[model samples]
Target chain A: MDIIIKDLCKSYGENTVLDSLNAVIGKGKITCLMGPSGEGKTTLMNILMGIEKADSGAVENMPQNKSAVFQEDRLCESFSAFTNVKIANDSLADDTIISHLEQVGLGDAVYQQVSTLSGGQKRRVALVRALLAEKDILFLDEPFKGLDEDTKKIVTGYLLNNTADTTVVMVTHDIDEASALGADVLYLKDGKITL
Target chain B: MKNKSKIEKTIAVAAALLLWQLASVIIGEEVLLVSPFKVLVRLSELIFEKEFYSAVAFSFIRITFGFVLAVAVGIIFATAAYRWHWAETMLWPYMSVIKATPVASFIILCLIWLNSSSLPVFISFLMALPIIYTNMLAGFKSTDTKLLQMADIFRFSFKKKLVYIYLPNIKPYFISACSVALGLTWKAGIAAEIIGIPDGSMGEMLYNAKLYLATADLFSWTVTIVCVSILFDKLFMKLINTMFKRLEDL
Candidate 1:
């Protein structure tokens, strides 16, 4: 189902972030929202993810089940990567998690606690967690922040392959990221989408 | 490595004991204080006495029961307060009263209201509950919101969320609460017993020594209580540490 957001309005105590924004995200396709920093990209993503409530707007056909790579990694640092993925999965085999990690080049560190992994490794773990989750929608918020160019290519390839045919909304500042993922880009400005 | 450290600690303690004996000999007054050697002799003699064992057992059981009860109730109340603002406001004045009011006053009032045997238990519980509740709630509140958001999005089960996320963050707070409350419970429990004068309790032994002007016995029993309190703290900490280490491994 297409996610139809209409007349979206939001404000934070005299600072308006979004105003009468409207967009339609196609079903089972990657939609990348790109804007300058502080252009309400993250805010819009948060509203769509149901983490932040829109002040006066309506979101239609949002999936009941969603998974995300938040602005932060948001991993359980004390637990192993395997445990984090397992916690999100419902009856998924352990081998499924291992395969996703291997595809993302995280196989060597899958058994290590997230606290012991490097920043890029942790980001990949977070990506694997989102991809492996049983969800109809996936959101990524600048998931490539700490990754180098080569690792980013490998992770982006894995993300695209895993999330293919799954409805995805990603927010990023990099055009290369949008191009690499073959996403339809929506330029966000003054809280409204300009496709 | 562990055994070597333990032996070194034992030698250090022995050296301290010798210094204590030397200081006591130079002072030469039993009422002022007894030497460590004398206290050890008294401790050995008391260990053979049935009354000593009974007193120790009685106090240990009651105080530990009170502590466990307090921990359970504190977590429940703290969770309730976390969920409802009104519950937090309502509990403030009562916790404040408990914190500010003296243990002796509570013991005397409780003596009128409860059986002599139960006074220590009641006092210990009253002393321990508020601190644990406050610390646990603080820990719960400090949990990362972003992580909770991720958990929500992924539809993690309540049990999994608690075990994987909450437990790791809440542990330090729980440990701190236990360490602080354990000592306070012991102090309040024995103080209550002394006021209530319960039979078959360490408090009774101390009181009897006081009445007869047996300063040596008083010091000996006081030392025994100190030893027991330290043992309880060390043993409780060891058990909790081992559990958390295993949990982290899992």
Candidate 2:
């Protein structure tokens, strides 16, 4: 089922972030939300993911099982990369988690603490954690922000392969990322979705 | 740099000891201030007595038990207060009273209610509770909201959330609380014992030494208490660190 947002509104004191916004996030497809800074792209995602309450809005068909790579890595810094991913879904086999980390070029650092990993490496760990979780929808907030070009290509490929049949709402400023993922591009401007 | 600091600490200790020796010699009265050498000799003699072992064991068990009990109860109370505002409100007055009231007052009041033998245990627990509760509560409040939101999205179970998020976040606070509470508990515990004069206790030994005006024995027992307290503090901290290390590794 698709997630439909109707008349979504959010405000902080006198500043309004999302005002009367409406959009449909398609089920089992990739959707990229793009916007200038402070346009409430993240606010929209947060509302849809039920992390934030909209001032006035209705979000329909919100998935019961959802996963997210938040704007920050939000990982357990003392835990290994493998443990961080494994914690998302304990039912997943050890080998499956190892293979996913290996795909992202983190096989050697799987057992190393996330604090020891570089920014790009931490991002990959967060991405892998979200991808491996048992969820109907995946939310990626600037998931590829810190990756180098070559690593980005590998990570994007891994994301595409894993999310082929999963609903994905990605927030990114890079249009090339949207095009590479073949996502339905939606521009968030003035708290409303366009195109 | 590390070796330099070690040498510095050694020098400071030696200078302090020399000053103590000089003061004792100038005083020249064992009844007033026993020299360090005389105190050491008294300690060596006390160790040969079976009563010394019993007294050490008696005080050690009660004080340590009190501290351990306080830690467990404090953590539980802190977690409760964290989860529920009502719990915090209910506990506020008690914690404040415990923090503000004099230890002697509590000891005297508790003497009217509890057995003398249990006095140290109660007093230590009372003294340590507020420190642990306040520090652990601060820790809980300081947990990252971002990680908690992530845990929610991932639908982490309570057990998983505790191990992966809460425990690690509260570790530094827990260690800190333990460090402060350990010293406070030992001091308060022994003070309680001295007031109550429980049989077969280090406090009773100290009381007897005072009664006989054996200043050397008094100094020796004082040193023993300091040694035991420091030893326990170090071992407990080591255990806590190892436990956290194992948790992180897992």
Candidate 3:
């Protein structure tokens, strides 16, 4: 089911974040939300993911089971990459988890703790966790923030390839990354979206 | 570095024993203070006596029971308090009173209601409860909110959230609370025994030593208590750390 947002309004005290915004996020396709800081991109994602609420609007058909690579790598620091991914979908076999880590070049550190991993490595683990989870919707918030060009391409390809059929709404500043994912782009400006 | 520290600890202990022996000699009165050698001799004799083991075991069992009970109950209540604001508010007064009131007061107060045999258990439980509850609750509160948000989005079960999120975040605080509480329970428990003077207990032995002014017996029993306390602390913490370390591996 596609997520449909209508007349969404959100605010923090006197500061209105999303003032009567609307968007139809297509199902089984990547929607990249691009905008400057302080725009409603993240707020929209939060509302759609049910992490936040819209004061006066309706979000229809928000998937029941969802996963995300948060703006911060929210992986458990003491757990290994394998464990972090397995934590998201523990029913997945260890062999499958190992291969998923292998796809993102985390095979070497699959058993190493997330705390010991570098920033880019941790981000990959977080991305892998999202991809491996048994969820109908995936949210990626600046998911490739720390990776270099080569690793970014590898991880981005790994992400898109594995999560082809899942509805993904990703937030990023990189238009090139948005294009590379072959995502339908939507730009947020002052609580309004430009498709 | 670890080996060097071990050697340094041994040297420090030897120096302390030498200072103790010099202090006994300078005092020059066996009634006032017994030499380390004499205390050691008394300990060896006490080791052979069935009553000594009985007293030690009696006090040890009750005190340990109190500490274990406090830890289990503290964790349960701290979790509930973390979940419900009113539970914390309701418990605040009792926790404050337990923390502020003197252990002697609790022992004396409990004496009127409880059997003298149970005084150590009750006193130790009272003394250790606040430490565990406060520390564990702080740990629960300090758990990363963002991670919890992520967990919610991912639809983690209560058991999964506890194992992956709560356990790791709260471990250091839990260990610290246990470290302090273990020592406190022993101190307060022995004090209760001394006051209550339960039969076939270490408190009775301490009371007898004080009444007869048997300095050797007093010194020997003091050493026994210290050894027992230190050993228990080390062993219990090692076990806790081992379990957490295993979780980290997972």
Evaluate chain B of model 1: give its TM-score: 0.91
Candidate 2's residue-wise lDDT over A76-122, tens digit each?
99899999999999999999999999999998998998999999999
Give the TM-score (0 to 1) of chain B in model 2: 0.98
Q: Tens digit of lDDT per residue, candidate 3, span B1-250?
A: 9999999999999999999899999999999989999999999999999999999999999999999999999999999999999999999999999999999999999899999999999998999999999999999999999999999988899988999999999999999999999999999999998999999999889989999999999999999999999999999999999999987776
Best by the DockQ measure: 2
Superposed model 2: Cα runs more than 4 Å off: B1-4
lDDT of 1 by residue, A61-117 (tens): 999989999989999999999988888885879899888889888889889989999
Model 3, range A15-96, lDDT digits (tens) per residue? 8888888888899999999999999788888888888888999999988989998889998998888888988887999999
Q: Give me the TM-scores for chain A across all models, comma-separated.
A: 0.97, 0.98, 0.97
lDDT of each: 0.90, 0.93, 0.92
Alpha-carbon RMSD of each model? 1.8, 1.3, 1.1
- Candidate 1, which segments miss by more than 4 Å at Cα? B1-15
In angstroms, give how far residue B168 of model 3 lies from its true place.
Answer: 0.9
lDDT of 2 at A44: 89
Per-residue lDDT over B1-250 for candidate 2, one digit per residue giving the tens place of the 0 to 100 score:
9999999999998998899899999999889988888988999999999998899999999999999999999999999999999999999999999999999999999899999999999998999899999999999999999899999999999988888999999999999999999999988988998899999999988988999999999999999999999999999999999998887777
Docking class of 1: high
lDDT of 3 at A161: 82
